[model samples]
Structure formats: structure tokens, C-alpha cells
Target: MNSAKKFFQNLAKYLAVALLVFIIVSPIYWILVCSFKPTRELIRVTPTFVPHTVTLFHYVGLLKETGFMTYFLNSIYVATGSAVLVVILTSLAGYSVYRCRYLGRRFFFNILLAIYIFPRVLLLLFLYPMFARLNLVDNLLSLVITYVGITAPLNVWLMRAFFTSVPLELEDAALVDGANRLQILFKIFLPLVAPGIAAVAINSFLMSYGEYLFASILIVSDRFKTLPVGMAQFLQQYEISWGWLASGSVLIILPPVIAFAFVGRYFVKGLTAGAIK
Candidate 1:
């Protein structure tokens, strides 16, 4: 009787969770279906769950007619660049903090954490004006630098936590065998902690990709605009093309989805590595 009762309880919990998942995913599934339909079918009084006849016209127009391709490429560049830079710099910073015995290390880490706790939006007011003074606005390089700085702190903190779980005796053994700090890091430590690095990369990529406020404020020219900003302009007050808008939205979400799907295991491993230990 007890086993039978437990079985039904577990079944009830699974059904509830499944329903919640369906609710969350339903809107995105609808958007994908609408992207294939035309403008008229998108807003018909009768809503259709699945489109009858699919049209590639909206996708084609966004690709060829509008500057969507340029924006898409820019987003790829910025996100990729920022993710790589953050992974490299933050790994080194984290290793130094976790593995080294430098003076005032705790103090430096405390200050760094405090900065991260402070909202980035607050920093934007000061940074935008300073960049304007230096004529750094509207430059891809400046945007890249800004992204790196913003993504670095949290990555460093997370990685530092992960690295704390690594055995220091391994480094000591390598050092006794005449290996230098850089050699030990490149050869022994990095390979073992690769999961954490991958997680940091994914986090940085998402942050850079979804960054709308900074991209909107910093970029002026249509050519240098990222996907987020382009999407904003795609939606306007008077006329919102549901089909075309949905198409653009689908296109915007594709890269991140593909990226996460590919690196998913690595991301999970990295984020949850030392978290369990």
C-alpha cells in the first residue's frame, strides 16, 4: 500500500512539472511557426497553431533587403570576442587568486566582489560620458573592450570558486619537477579544469548577445548595430510585422541555441564542478 501511494505521488509531481515546461516553451514554439507564415496569416482573427502554407519571403527579405545580416554578424563577433577574452583573462585572474600567496589578495578579492554587487546600470552613466569624451563611441573595438571588462568580474569570481577545489599538491609536484608557473598552468591545471572554462565562455556569450541597453546607447550607425538593437528597431509603435518580426526573432535566437546545444555538457560540467565538492 505504501509503495503504491508513493508511486502516484511521484506521478502527480511529474505531470505538474511537465505542464509547467509546456507552458514556458509554448510561446517560443508559436513564434517559430509564425515565422514561416506571411504577415496576413500571422494576425488573422482565427489563430492557427500550425501554419498551413509556409513562406520564406520574410526570412529572405530580412537577409537581403534590410541590414539584418550585418547586425547578425556584428553580434557574432562581439559575443565571440568577449567570451574568448573573458575566459582567458578570468582564468588567469582566478588561478592567481585561488592558487597564489600574494599580499592583500583577500582585500583585492573583496573589492572586486563589491564592484560586481553594484549594478552595471549605475556604472553606465559614468562610462558613457567618459567614452564620449575620448571619442570611443560607435567603435567595435571600444564595444569589445567594454564587454570584456563587464563580463570579467563575475567570471573571475565563479572560476576562483571552482579552482579552489583543485588540488594544490599537483601544482607543487609540477614545480618540484622544474616546471614554471606558466608551464604548469598550460600543461597540468588548465586541462583538468576545462569544464569551468567552458561554463564561463557560455555565460559571457549570452551576456554579450543579449546586451541591449549598452548596444543601443553606444552604437549610432546602422552598420555597426548588434542583433539586439536591430531587433528593437524591427519592432516599432505604429506597425509591428508579426510574421516578419517573428522571423527576425527566430533568427536572433538561433545562434545562442546552437551554441548552447553544442557546448551544453561542458557548460553544465563547468558550472557544477566545484559546486558539488
Candidate 2:
């Protein structure tokens, strides 16, 4: 009877985990199936999970008829650039504060942390005038600037915590070997924190990839539109064309999905590195 009870418990646990995984992945699977289906097929009375009349029409239409390809390229450039830039800036900034001792450091860093939790919408209003004065409105560069600022704080905080766990002895030994600060960072310290750095890259990529709020407000022209804003317009314009929208959306979401799949382990490691230790 005890063995029987244990078997049931194990079965229940496996069932629960399977259900959770299915829930998480079902939407993505649905989206992919819909992307390949014909519009008529997608909206059939009895929806089929597999595409009955699979067509590349949606994918081809998205690229040819709409400016989706351009939007895709813009998003890629922005996301990649933002990820690289933020990782560099935040890593450097966090390392400085985390490892170096200086005056007013705690006060300044505390203020940054406080500011980190505030609403980002506040910046849209406050910086509207400043951005207009600088002629940055509707500019991709402006998007970069906004994204960098938006991403930097939380990433810095994450990185600061990550850097705290690096053993001081490693750094001290490098210093004893007559390595300069830059040498110590690039050669020894940065390599040690590469997992955390990859995590930062993942965070920055996702933020700059799929974010809607700031992109919607800041970018007004079709020429400068990123994927999220483009998705909204594409959906509204092709409201009746479910397949097209779904395909476009699936395509739009692909990059971040690929990025996370490749570096997801690093993100998990970085997030839990100090937490467990």
C-alpha cells in the first residue's frame, strides 16, 4: 500500500509538470501552426491544430506587400545594438560600484536604485521637450537612447549583485601580478562573469525586441518603426487576414525566441548564482 501510494504521488508530480510545460508552450505552437495555414483554414469552424492548407502566402505577403522586412531589420539592429551597448555600459558601471571604493558611492547608487523602480512613462512626458529640442523625435537613435536608459538600471543592479560574488582573492592575485584595473577586468574578472554578462545580453535583447510602450510613443514614422509597433499596425490593417498577422507575429517573435533558447541557461545561472550561494 505504501509503494502504491508512492507510485501515485510520482505519477501526479509528472502529470503536473507535463501540464505546466504544455501550458507554457501551447501558445507558441498554435502561433506557428496558424502562421502556415491559409486565412480561411485558420478560421475554420472546427479549428485544426495542424495546417490543412499550408501556404507560404502569409510569409510572402508580409515581406512583399507590407514593410515588415524593413521593420524586422530595424528591430534586429536596435535589439542587437541595445543588448551590446547596455551590457558594456551596465557591466562597467556595476563593476565600478561593486568592486571600487569611493566617496558618495552608496548615496549615488542608492539613488539610482530608487530611480530604477519608478514608472518609465514619466520619462515620455518629461523628456518630450528635451528630445524635441534635440531633434530626436521619431529617430531610431532616440529609441536606442531611451532603450539604453530603460535597460541600464535593472541590468546594473543585477550585474552589481553578480559581481559581488566574484571572489576578491582572484582580483587581488591579478593586482599582485602587476595587472592594471583594465587588465584585471578584461583578462580575469570579466571572463569570470561571462555568464552574468550573457544574462544581461538576454535581458537587453528581450527589452529592445518586444517592447511596445516606448516604441509606440517615440516612433511616429513608418521608416523608423520597430517590430512591436509594426505588429500593431500590421494586425489592424490586416484584421481579417488572421494567417498573415499570425505569420508576421511569429516571424517578429522569432529572434528573441532564438536568443533565449541559445542563452537561456546563462540567464538562469546568473539569476540564481548569488541567490543560492
Candidate 3:
């Protein structure tokens, strides 16, 4: 009876997880279907789960007719730049907080945590005026700086956790071998925390890539607009092109999905370990 009960509980858990997965993935599946379906099929009263006729018209239109490629490239530039900056600054900051003894270290960490929790909307009010004063408004560099500021604190905490888990004896041995602080950081410490770095990179990349609010507010010119902002232009005052919108959505997700597929295991491991530690 106990064995049977255990089996039933396991089955129940599996069913619940399957249901949750279906709920989350359903929208993605629908968007993919809509992307391939022609305009006639998309606006039907009843939606079809599977497309009878798959067409690449929307994809072709997005690439050939619109400024999608420009937006895509812009997103790539900003996301990559922001992620690199976050990783570099966070790694150093994390190591310093973890290893170096300093006055107000705890206070500094508390401030970071507080910033991490603070609503981003609140920061925008302050950030905009400062950027405007500096003539940084509507600039890609401004976007990169904002993204780094938003993502770095959390990433710093993640790296700090990973750094704390590194064995101090290893650093001591490296020190004994005449390795300097930078050498120890680059050669010895970095390898051990590679998973954490990957996690931070993925997080930073995704955050900047998909961020709409700041991008929309900061970028005005069509030349500098990111994917999310560019795609939103489809929903104009008069009409919405569902097909092109779906195609853009599909395209936007592809890079992140491919990235996560490669580093997913490490990302999960790093985050879980950091949280536990």
C-alpha cells in the first residue's frame, strides 16, 4: 500500500510539472505557428494549432522590407557590450568584497542588495535627467551603461558567492609561487568560477536583449532602436501586422535560446550553488 501510494505521488508530481511546462510553452508554440501561417489563416475566428500551409513570407518581409536586421544588430551590440562590462566589473567587485577586508564592507553589500530590490522605474526618473544633462540621451552607450548598472549588482553578488566557495588554500599556494593578485584572479580563481561567469553572462545578455522600457525611452532614432523597440513599431495607430510581429518575436528568441542551450547546465549549476552558498 505504501509503495503504491509513493508511485501515485510521483505520478501526480510528474503530471503537475508536465502541465506547467505546457502552459509556459504554449504561447511560444502559438507564436511559431502564427509566424508560419499566412494572413488569411491567422485572423480566423478559430485558431489552428498546426499550420496546414507554412510560408516564410513574414520572415522574408521582416528581413527584406523592414529595418529588422538593423535592430537585431543593435540589440546584439548593446547586449554583448553590456554583458562584457557586467562580467568584468562584477568579477573584480565580487572578488574584492569576498577577499579584501575593508571598513563598511557589510554596508556596501547591503546597499547593493537594496539597489537590486529597488524598482527600476524609480531609477529612470533620476537617470534620465542626468543622461540628458550629459548629452547621453538616445545614445547606445547610454543604454549600455544603464544595462550594466541594472545587471551588475545582482551579478556581483552571484560572483561573490562563487568566490567565497573557492578554497583559500589554493590562493595561498598561488601566492607562495609568487603569483600576483591579478594573476591569481585571472589564472587560478577565474577557472574555478567559470560556471558562475557563464550564468552572469547569460543573465546580463538576456536582460539587455529583451529590455523594452528603457530602450524605448532612451532610443528615439530608427537607426539606434533595439529589437524590442523596433518590433513594437508594428503595432501602429491604425493596424497591427500579426504575421510580421510573430516572425520578429521568433527571431528575437532564437539567439538567447541557442545561447542557453549551450551553457544551460553550467548556468543552472552556478545559480543553484550560489543560492545555496
Estimate the TM-score of every prediction: 0.91, 0.93, 0.93
Candidate 1 residue spans exceeding 4 A from truth? 1-7, 273-277
Give the Cα-based TM-score of candidate 2 against the true structure: 0.93
Q: What is the lDDT of residue 170 in candidate 3?
A: 96
Q: Write the per-residue lDDT of candidate 3 for residues 1-277, one digit (tens) a residue.
A: 9999999999999999999999999999999899999999999998889997899999998799888999999999999999999999888888888888999888877877776577888878788888999999889998999999998888877665567888899999999999999999999998998988888899899899999989988888999999999888855733788898899889999999999998777667767777774
Model 1 sits at a Cα RMSD from the real structure of 2.2
User: Which portions of model 3 show Cα errors greater than 4 Å?
Assistant: 1-11
Q: CA shift at 112, candidate 3, in angstroms? A: 1.3
Q: Could you tell me the C-alpha RMSD of candidate 2 in Å?
A: 1.8
Clashing pairs in 3: none
In what order do the candidates fall by lDDT, top score first? 3, 2, 1
Assess each prediction's global lDDT (C-alpha) against the native.
Answer: 0.83, 0.84, 0.88
Which digits, one per residue and each the tens of the lDDT, describe model 1 over residues 1-277? 9999999999999999999999999989989998999777888999889898799988987787677899999999999999999999988888888888889988877766776676778777877887898898886666778888888877876675458778989999999999999999989998887877877898899889889878888888989999989878867633776766888999998988988997777667655664565
